[model samples]
Target: MDLPVTVGIDGSESSLAAADWAAREALLRDRPLRVLHALPLMPHLLPARAAGGRPGGDLLHEVEHVLAMRHPDLRMRTEEAHDAAGAALLAAGEDADLLVLGARGSDGFPELRVGSTALLLAARTGCPTVVLPVEPPGPHPRDLVVVGVDARRPAEAALDFAFAAAHRYGLPLRAVHAGSVPRADLGGEAALLAGALEPWKAARPEVEVVADAESGGPGRVLVEASAKARLLVVGRRPAGPAALLGPVVHAVLHHAACPVAVVPGA
Candidate 1:
C-alpha cells in the first residue's frame, strides 16, 4: 500500500500553503509527498503574464527547495508541460494516491475562475483530491471535518471520501446541507437534510454526524465550520446549477482556515 499526495506548487503564498498541507496529508496517509511544480511548455502555451513575470521553472525550483527544508523525508518530483494546470496535474494524477491544489488562484470572478486545477481535478479526476484553502482560521484545528451535501441527494463518492478522511484522521465528520429554502419552509430544512443523509448514517454508525442549515451563504457557513475543522469536502456537479463552483466554493477556497477537499460530481 503506497499512499502518495501530488501537490501543485507555484511559489505563491497559496501554493506554499498547499505544499505544507499536502505534506501533512501525505504523512498521515503514510505516503510519500510529490511536490509537483509544473512548468508551462512555453510562452504561447501560457499567457505572457500568467505566472506574474517569473519563469515557471523558477517557481518549480523554489517549491522543491521549500518542501525539502520542511520535509526531509518527503519525496518530490517536478514536470513541465504546455497543458492547462488542471490538465497537466490530471495527467500526473493517473497513478497518484491523492491530488491537491490551492482552492483558487489569483483569478477573480464572474470572469474569475473558481474551477482551478483543484476544482477541475476533484470534479473530473478518477482519484480523491483535496483543495487546500489559503485564508483565515488555520491548519487542522481540532480535526473536525465537514463535507457539503446537496439537498437533492448526498453525493456518495464525495461523502465516502470525506468519511474515509475523517476516519483516517480520527476526526468527527459533519455533513453540511448548503442551499436556499423557500421562505415558508424554513423549519423543514433540517429534516430534509437528515433524510438525505440516511444511508451515510447507517453505513458509518460510529462516525459523528452533525447537520447545519445556514441562514447566510453556504460558503461562509463552510468556512466557519472549517475554522474549527481540519478539512472541508465539497462535491462539484458536472453541468447544473450545483455543478458550478459558485460563490460558496469561491469563498471557501479563499477564506477556509483548513484544507478543503473539492470533490467534483453531482
Candidate 2:
C-alpha cells in the first residue's frame, strides 16, 4: 500500500507552505508525510571552509533540518544525486500517494516561469501533484477545486482526478469548459461538461458539482478563477499526438492562489 504523501522541501517559504499542507493532508488521510530534499553534486554551493572539507553536498542537510523544525512527525529523507531535480522527485514519488511542490523556486520567477518543476512532475509522475503559491487565496472562491476541460479524452481523466481530489477532502468540484473560441452553439457545451462529470458526481453524492463555461479565452479566465480557488486541475499536455497546451496552464501555474494538479493523458 502507498504509505502517504511526499513533499519536496527546500529553504523557501513557498516550500514551507507545501510542507505544512502536505502534513495536514497526510494527517487527514491517516498516512505518513515523506519530506524529501535532493541535493545535486554542486560543490560551489558550500561555504569556503566546508567547500574543500566535504565532497558530498550538505545543502540538502540544511533542508532536512528546516523541514524537521516545522514538521517533526513527518519522515524526512535526503538524496544525493547527480541527476536532475525532477528525476529525483519521480524516483521518490514512485511509492507516494501525492507529490507536493512550490510554484516558484528559491531564485524566484522573474520571467513568469519558463519551465516549472510542478509541471514536470505532472507530466511524468504516476501520482497527483500539488503546487503551493506564495500568498493566501482570495476571500471567496467559486469552487473548492476548478478543473479545466477541452475537446480531448484526457480532459475526462483530468475531471476524474479533480472530482477524486474534491471527494477526498470533502470539497465541492467545479467543472470548467475552457476552449480556444466559443462555438456557434455554445448551449450544449455546458451540458456536455456536466455530462462528462455527472457520473463521478453521482458516484460520490456527498460532494457538490458545478459546471462553469467561459466564452472568452482559457488562460486569463483560469488565472482569474485560480486567484480564489483552493485548488486547480488541468489536463497535462505531455507530448502526445493530440497534445495541446494552452497558455492557461502556464498562467495558473505561475499565479494561482493554491495548489494545482495536472493530470496527464492515460
Q: What is the TM-score of each candidate against the true structure?
A: 0.73, 0.79
RMSD of 2: 3.8
Q: Which residue runs of candidate 2 sit more than 4 Å off their true CA positions?
A: 47-83, 108-116, 140-143, 151-154, 180-184, 237-246
Per-residue lDDT over 21-88 for candidate 2, one digit per residue giving the tens place of the 0 to 100 score = 88777766667777776555566663343354543345556666765787676665555555556788
Candidate 1 global lDDT: 0.70
Measured by lDDT, the strongest candidate is 1
The C-alpha lDDT values of all candidates are 0.70, 0.68
- 1-266, model 1: which lDDT tens digit per residue? 57478887655666777778788778777788877656666665553434566557666777778777887877666655556677778886777888887766544233432345656665566566777654545444466888887767778878888888887887788888766666567558778788888887788877887876656567877877877887788766554434345566667766777777766554
In candidate 1, what residue range of length 10 has the lowest lDDT sum? Answer: 106-115
Q: Clashes in each model (backbone N, CA, C under 3 Å)?
A: 6, 0
Question: Candidate 2, which ten residues in sequence have the lowest lDDT sum?
Answer: 46-55
Please report the TM-score between candidate 1 and the true structure. Answer: 0.73
Report the error of model 1 at residue 35, Å: 2.1
Off by over 4 Å in 1: 1-3, 43-69, 72-84, 104-124, 136-143, 182-187, 239-248
